[model samples]
Target: MHLRKVYTIARHEYTVTVRRPGFIVLTATVPVLGLVVAVLVLVAGRGLLAQVDTLVGAMEKPIGVVDKSGYFSPVLPAFADDFQRYEDETEVYRAVDEGRLQAAIVIPPDYVQTGRVYVYSPQNVFQRVSLEDSHRLRAFLAVHLSRPWVPEEVLVRLSEPLVTLTPVASRQETAGPWASFTQVLVPYMVAILLVISVFASSGYLIQGLAEEKENRLVEIIISSVTPMEWFVGKVVGLGAAGLTQMGIWMLTSLALSGGAMLALVAVSPIPWYRWGLFLLYYALGYALYAVLQAGLGALGTSTRETQQIAGLASVVAFVPFMLSGLVFTVPDAPLVRGLSYFPLTAPTMMIFRLAVFSVPTVDVVVSLTLLVVSIPVAGWIGAKLFRLGILFYGKRPSLAEIWYALRSA
Candidate 1:
């Protein structure tokens, strides 16, 4: 392995990537655009509720609410700030027909506990509803919570609604705390970006390799450096490029949303230590995936074949993200727990669960250690595959051939 050649490859990658105006614009400005969009959504959402009276006037017509309990349930008191009242659900429909209201609501007696709130509006016509519905529901729950009779169990029940972790014992999981888990969403985006990055870099790796092979330039580069040095350096340089782009995007995103940014800093509910854990896992995760991408790149005789291999790896990387919603809802389900221990899916699923709730220290230690150990092991295996894959081309090789590559010097 020649340091000189490695440095040269890295320098070339950095320069080529930075000098492309398209890459520069995308790398630098994308974060700003993302941040701006986020801020606009938050600001506009907050502002939309500012002028309640004006909003009331803007509604097309009156809507009705039915309590169905024979008692007059006070008109959502806030709804009074918006809609004119109608006699009943039927009358609300009539008023809608008469161009008097947009929709109607029916609050069944068990609406809160049952999660069965009903809405009625003209069929096949678009119906607009008021904002703060979530606020209204949450406020309603909070007030109900203040009542003397609501049990602690019911409150916790509503929060997760699934998993229902018993908190059997307390242990200091390296996962840290809740906010630390939000970074799971961070890697989710990372997974997609890095997968794309791997795709992009693998192209850079293989096409550069193959183009060299085809144009008779492979010998020129190899004469100056060993294949292993060149391969390792190219992978490192491009990975650095990916992380730099991702970091800039992350900081840019945070900077753009000033309010949330401040709130996150001030009231960060997640534990700080988990950041150490996140970095640990992120590095391991990225290394494991990037090396695989490198091996895939080294194997392909052509660019098209490289993509097929890269796409397969991308799907493998994305399995956790595809099931993120489930991971959020059922963090401790046997399947979730099982996959989280499995090397390929653990980073996303385990980290996400670690964020939302307390996991055992053993689980945390075992999972993180596995990923960390796997990184170099996988990279070495990939490097072997890569080193051998470089020379074997023309016909697609067998699993025996791939296995032989893995064992190659």
Candidate 2:
């Protein structure tokens, strides 16, 4: 394997791919869509808030009151403007009908025994009471009734009590049931991004291989550089392209958020050291899948056929994502551990585990070791398949023939 030849192939592949219209469009699509959605949300949110404010302002109009219950006969100075005093229900009804009051309320003289209050408002075809008006009336009653006996500070507390919420874990080191939504969400996002990049890059590799084989370019490519070198070069070039896509996406997100997301990451539960492990797993995972994708591309008779086979592999990679609920609930379960050690699922599964819990050092080391060890083994199998299958045409080889080729290799 010549370094110069491999470098030349890699450079050619990279340049050709980046220049392709599909690559350019696909790379830009995510950022463009994200920006569009964000803008729409901001605009819609502002419009909605404005509408709410307008409705609230309308509701704030003076509500005529006929408080015969005697508890709130003399409206407090603080609420006098909000609750305008009236002589009886007849005057309140006239005020509401004339649009002078948005709503009115009358308390019965038997209020202490029956606790009944009459709410009066103009009824339309579909009448709905204003929530703001009801809340205002309730607050007015609570304060005036308690004012004679309760302290000012106590009245305030009775009107609006302060409640603090705290999440407590059974143990100091464990947060399994007590994990925050952000903690689980951040890791899941990372896993999805990595999985998408890996498969997208691998897809490019397979498409290129299939097209080259269709054009009989592989014959000439192999003659100039060994199949293994060609495979390595394509994987490197395509993987770099995938990284470029991811970088653009991340930079776009950071730019749109004004680096707020970076600040969020800084305070996230994931440790700094785990980021290095993340990169290692991503690279190894890409290499392992690239090997499988390359072999599938070389082995199939058509691009469509090759893609269909690769799609099955793509499903396998998403197994960890599908089991995410289980991961968060039972990170140390046998099934979760089994997936973490499995080569195809390990990268994403370990990534998920890292975010939700403090994964054991032994588990991390073992999972990483398995991923590290799988690439070469996959590559060797891929090489044998590529060597024999690339030259064959007309019909796909049978399992028996494939076994012989592996044996020969």
Name the candidate that leads on TM-score. Answer: 2
lDDT of 1 by residue, 1-409 (tens): 7788788897776666656675677776777678677778778867676665444553534455566532324443434543454556776667656655555666667765775556775533323334225444344435333435556566444433556334333443332354444445544544465455555555455544455445555567767777678777777776676667767766776667665754654444446676566566666667777777777766776777866775577567567777888877777787877777777677666656666666778778888878877777777877776666666646556789878666654
Clash pairs for candidate 1:
61-100, 61-101, 62-100, 179-270, 181-355
Q: Name the top lDDT candidate.
A: 2
In angstroms, the error of model 2 at 234 is 1.2
Local distance difference test values of all predictions, in order:
0.62, 0.78
Q: lDDT tens string, model 2, 301-395?
A: 88888787666776788999889889989899999999999999998998888876889999999998988888888888888888777887645
Worst 10 residues of 1 by lDDT: 123-132
Question: Which sections of candidate 2 miss by over 4 Å?
Answer: 34-49, 52-162, 169-179
Clashes per candidate, residues 3 or more apart or on different chains? 5, 0
lDDT of 1 at 86: 51
Task: TM-score each candidate.
Answer: 0.63, 0.77
